[model samples]
Target chain A: MKLDLYKEHAAEYKAVKKPIFVNAAPAQYLAVDGQGEPGGECFEQCVGALYAMAFTIKMTLKAKGQDYAVSKLEALWYPPDGGADFETAPKSEWRWKLMIRTPDFVGKQDLREAVKALQRRGKNANAGQVTLEKLHEGECVQMLHVGPYEQLCETITAMLAFAEANQRRQHGLHHEVYLSDPRRVPPERLKTLLRQPVRKA
Target chain B: MRDRTRHSYEQRILRVLTHIQQHLDGPLELDALAGLACFSPYHFHRVFTGMIGEGLMEHVRRLRLERAAQRLKQSRRAIADIALEAGYGSHEAFTRAFRERFGAAPSAFRRRHAPLPVPDGRAVHYTPDQVIRFSPKRSSRSMSVAIRTIRPQRVAFVRHVGPYDAVGEAWERLMARAAPMGLLGESCQFIGVCYDDPEITPPERIRYDACIAVSGPIRPRRDLGVQVIAGGDYAVTTHFGPYQRLGRTYARLCGPWAARSGRELRAAPSFEVYLNSPEGTEPGDLLTDIYLPLMPAPGTE
Candidate 1:
């Protein structure tokens, strides 16, 4: 049977109408960082390379009878250097870390070997850029935003207000957990979990 | 930094973490781990700190102590033995380190049988079993438990030996085997008897039996087996989430809740009764009643 992380941790991946606090659990991810807009060439290359490595590792583990469902794509968005804020930062100055969660059984050896194999096949030149890292974003305020990406600020504003009323303040990078693929799901129906790590005021 | 250079650094640090996890009981000199990552000890420490957000030795010490904490709670091993296994030279040294990390002495911690100390939020810790990602303990989750008596049940079951996540095949086979034999009745209760705690037992060695309660005559077949569910006084609770997360409810039911409820645990294996099907219900709405057997009265046996 295939292990589904979303199903295993239903509360963590659930979609919520209003902003709510959650203790986001620790997880391992295959991450690639870049500076650009979401759909830029570098971003696309990194996403493709990350998935290539993910599939390679997944297949290898599946052969060993450790199969799992590939989790959703997620990203951490940061403003460019020099004290620029995300709201006003130019699209070119956006720094993002694209990530896909990997199962615990996937080790550094699996990733290193996957890179070597992909390199040998001359597929995904950016394969080596994908690295394994564990992230623990504890005590976050999150809400499900359903619609176009351009309309996210409205949700963020409402979320910020909710947090302020609850005596919490954002303390980490802007994080997004995509539950639906943009290409597959309609923009009106696309579901994205907007998360912001927060701490008591 | 170039992507290649960044990847190299991240990969080396990951390798070091893996090495540390595999050899926590053995010698974990910074020089040895650095050599494994193909770097000088000096450079390796800085790189590891830069990537993992903790000093290398600090990380190792925390992992060793955390592992010791797990052993303290899960087994009856002597503190000295646990200290030795955690790479501490002496019990005193282990206790001091454990106190600093967990804020309580090892014996006191064991006496209380409290949950492990809150992790440092670094996402790097020690696990006795497989190297899985960390999740917050479900001890704080609210639970409504009821003590009730359950009648013994006769059932047909299919045994499964693997990770709990991979029990679908057994269920599929059981359904197929039971459907044609006129055993799929509206009153039949789908049950699962879990024989091992995944946290304590290795994933591959864990045992589970997918069963369906049957009242009529049934014979043991090649693929299916018949058994009696020895039911008695059970502390029952409803788990309102995905079946994959049933372990959390079990942990709560058996851990703090059981320890405080003043009920002695029985030797019988615990089982679950599905309240609803997962076919159409939302994952969050799926419910399962977990029944943990309790010891009978002194003379009732």
Candidate 2:
């Protein structure tokens, strides 16, 4: 879990918190919450779902001469009260949010155009409503972690403490960049990059 | 027909040389090697010499003696066994060849070349370690990659025997034919596949393929047929140099990096994908991406 993705995409992760308006097509993803412990099973499901959506977007856009950037990705975890063992609970819930930016994000006009093209091909195309949001850019500390997702809590805590002691405030939600495809990589050797945007306090 | 079979004969000789190195202590003769190549001894010697640029017997003799010299200084094997395994009739004959090649007799060489002990008491037995420590570090910290999984390809190939420099003409012919088929493309890198293990393959019989990827299911046309290149995870590194220097880069990346990272190298064929042609760039400026397959080590979490 040595976060090979971050090492490979260091430049992209380093340029965070800058507002970049993006017009992205609608994508389907399995939303997950990050309130509870992030285990191996939870991470595998989350990444697999995200990759499928991203690949579909890339392929769809490439066919239409459009490029998009993954602007924001965050997982909201819902742990039980008192930080109880959610694993033993009857049901665990997670929510995953991804904001992808394309070249045109002014309004629903771009979405209507895409929907029209898909309808012509006789496909169930929902060019969902589009909105423009500010994507903040700034400096951030990142590390590649190779291990079970549950084990990452300790590392994340350490990183947060480091950031706090250094007078840097956490500016945005946390995001994990998937490097090795979970199917190809073993649970033990899976690599994910933990990136948290920060600004000078 | 003889011309068509010549390439196959060369490959057989290289494989035989690899086998000989693995069993250096066993008997190896021209007849035995000819049998392995499925050719008569009369034709075997001629074809081997023509492709490898040395007489078959002479090359084997030199390689065996060279390995003996290394073993003598590196290991505590009895000198008599080393001599016998080198195919020498006596210790005296082995010592003579050792001195001729290495400029020192076996006993004298061993005394002067005893391995140095590190602080942990492990002997530093390999010369490459010392060389790597002194080599300049790469300025860039990035690795190049082409995000594509190439399907299995059938190649019409010619195995080059001996040092790579002597086999340039043969490769030129292979590349010429492959190019017309549109088998070589920008996305598909031209590959030179090395099959023989360096430790065992004699220098005279090292095997290499000058190959390009083909478009479809290959039908054996004339003496050409298809061989599948399996798909898997590969550790890719780009090297900018003449083809002759590729082996050094591979030795550095695979031999050292894989060893240090505690990863096991899979038995898949490691190859160099040529990014630029000799016509487009000078030989020294050619770019080649070297791919080494890797797998997880046993019992590692």
- Predicted model with the maximum TM-score: 1
Scored by lDDT, the top model is 1
User: How many residue pairs clash per model?
Assistant: 0, 22
The parts of candidate 1 lying over 4 Å away from their true place are: B1-301
lDDT of each: 0.76, 0.52
Worst 10 residues of 2 chain B by lDDT: B128-137
Give the true-structure RMSD of model 2.
Answer: 16.7
Candidate 2, A35-80: lDDT as tens digits: 2224445444443333333333433443345433432333423334
CAPRI docking class of candidate 2: incorrect
DockQ per candidate:
0.01, 0.01
**Pairs of colliding residues, candidate 1:** none
- Model 1 Cα shift for residue A130 (angstroms): 0.5
Candidate 2 — what's its lDDT?
A: 0.52
Q: Interface Cα RMSD for all candidates?
A: 19.7, 15.6
